[model samples]
Target: MRNLLIFCYFLLFFIGLSCKETKKEDINITTDDIEVSDNLQAVTKKSKSILFFGDSLTAGLGLDIEDAFPAIIQRKIDSLGLSYQVINAGLSGETTAGGKNRIDWVLKQDVDIFVLELGANDGLRGVPLSETRNNLQAIIDFVRQKNPEVKIILTGMQIPPNLGVEYTTEFKKIFPELAAKNKLELIPFLLENVAGIPDLNQADGIHPTKEGHKILAKNTWEVLKDVI
Candidate 1:
């Protein structure tokens, strides 16, 4: 009778041990699942942000936010599985001086890439080419000082033919000169494909239309892909 009681107790003990082992296995699986979830979330949160700091050209003046060049670039980044955010800091009628004035405010935001596309309005307003260059240089220096790692892509602009060849030539040189001096990337001209195309321009030839914005996005991406 004692032997029978001992056998029954051993059987119950073995069953209890098996149940505890199974529970431990379940807990380990749950822990692994939670860890994987946390890792995924962290990856999702570390996405990069690119800032498009320019005039109306970058702002999509007449177009919707989604149609802006910055937004289009964001879409490309997403399609390519590159984690990025494109912040539009464009202001219509903004000159190089205006850009310089507001650069500090723009820098307060988390900016990774700054697509500097000023000077067009300055050229249009007949601002001194030297003044334009000075303003742009200041803005570039400030940005570099604040975030050395932040990439800058300078976009060149040409003055209207009526602005006289001398003035236009001087205005044209500002971008290349600054780019070379700062060792920054240059887009050459933001309106390369769509500048003079009547169909690409809105009522005012100064600002680009929706179609023009599409081309601008392509121009930006060509240089941006390299940096990203």
Candidate 2:
């Protein structure tokens, strides 16, 4: 009976020790999972982005990507101690119709400020003025739907008079009209100091040169600083 009692006690002791060891292993696994989850969260947390969406002009045609106005704007933001990322979603040859189609994909990430520089290609192509206006309005609406608090900076663009006087006049009015209707900040003529200047333009006479982009950045900064 004594021997049997001792054996029973030893068996109970071993069982308790095994259960404790299993619990410790389970705890270690849980701790590792939590650490991994925390690391992933830290890695994915990103700064709010100032998205520059437009065409070849915004894409920095005939210039280095870093020389683009959007990148220059990024430098300005950094200098001001702002915590914002600059995303250049500019595509060469993109028109208002294309922009309307692409805005959804471009806005997949969080955007704090949207600097819209489209409609130049649309005007140059002589696309219907009403269609261009509607497409631009749609893009703006989509951005607002994505983030109701997003601030928009619409940049005005002008084309040569080859598209007929009536078309040119109406095209020029679109930007301000949209700005007024949407209550958005407007940069009248993004190429104010650079347009019509030989030195400021590329060989194609359409896209702005590196020096011209500096002036463009200044124009954008003037209106952008007020909004942000």
Candidate 3:
């Protein structure tokens, strides 16, 4: 009887050790799972961001979201296996003043590349050249303040002859002037092949159609690809 009792005690001791080992294994598994989750979150947070900030031209007014140039750029980035995420902050009919007012809110997140495409609506509205320049400069300054390392791409815009030659010429010069002053990359013209072409533009003749967006994307990609 003494021998049996001793054997039972030994069995209980071994079982307890087995249970503790199993518990340790479970704890290790849980720790590994948590570590994996943390790694995934870190990767997501570290992905670079490219922000396309602009007006109706960038918004793709009459077309689908996928038809927009920003979306097209996203597709290109994805195809190249690039990790950069594109944020389209375009708003319809947004003037330089509107962009200036709204930029503070828009820049609440990280921005690696800032493609600025404003001042078109200002030109259309016949807003004073000085006011447009001031507002645009303010927006640029705000962006620089938000991210000093951000690569700025200023897109040039031109208005119809209704705005008069002096105003139109001055407006056209704004982008290059700002680009030179700020040492920013210039796209020269955003609507290069799309503007003035009836087939590329929508019925309003201001916004580009889906087919036109492809050309615009090409134009943007030419300069943007080099920077990225």
Candidate 4:
């Protein structure tokens, strides 16, 4: 009887030891999985952002959101396997003053690249050149204040002499002057080849057609590529 009892005790002890070893192996496997998850998370890249802030031109008035120049830029970035998120913060008829007013809200998101395209409406409306300049400067200041490291690209614009040559010329000068003052990148005349071309513009003769937006995207990509 004593021998049988001792044999039973030894069997139970060996069973408990085997169970402990199995539990330890499971814990090791769980730890390895956790470490692998952490490593994968560490290697994953976080996408930077490019924000296009302007009026109807940026907003793609009369067109789908995906057809906008910003969306086109996004496709270009994606094609190259670049990790940049393009945000079109364009509003139809947004002026420099309007941009200045809403820039804070726009800046709520992370913006590594800022493309400013606001003065067209201001110039078209014959808003005072000083007001336009001041508003643009304020908007630039707001962006800088939010993040001094932000890369701002000011898009140049031109208006007809109906606003007077002085106004028109100064309006054209606003972008470069602000660019120089702020040490920002400049896209000279955002509507370079497309502007004044009847085929490129819509019936309104103001906004660019889909093909025209492609040219806009190309013009932007020219300077944008160098920066990014």
**Which number leads on TM-score?**
3
TM-score of each: 0.79, 0.80, 0.81, 0.80
The Cα local distance difference test for each model comes to 0.85, 0.91, 0.89, 0.89
**Tens digit of lDDT per residue, candidate 3, span 79-197?**
89888888889999898988999998999986999999999888888999999999989989999998899999999888887968998999899989999999999999888888899
lDDT of 2 by residue, 112-151 (tens): 9999999999898889999999999999999999999999
Query: What lDDT would candidate 4 get against the real structure?
Result: 0.89
lDDT of 1 by residue, 105-186 (tens): 9889556888898988888888887898999999999998989888999987887777899998888988998999999999
**How does residue 40 of candidate 4 score in lDDT?**
62
Candidate 4, residues 167-226, lDDT tens digits: the string is 887788888988998899999989999998999999999999999999999999999998
Off by over 4 Å in 3: 1-46
- Best-fitting candidate, scored by lDDT: 2
Which 10 consecutive residues of model 4 have the lowest summed lDDT? Answer: 38-47
CA displacement after TM-score superposition, residue 37 of candidate 2 (Å):
20
What C-alpha lDDT, on a 0 to 100 scale, does residue 172 get in candidate 4? 89
Regions of candidate 4 where Cα sits further than 4 Å from its true position: 1-46
RMSD of each: 8.1, 8.2, 6.8, 8.4
- Determine which window of 10 residues in candidate 3 has minimal summed lDDT: 38-47
Q: Which residue pairs in model 1 clash with each other?
A: none
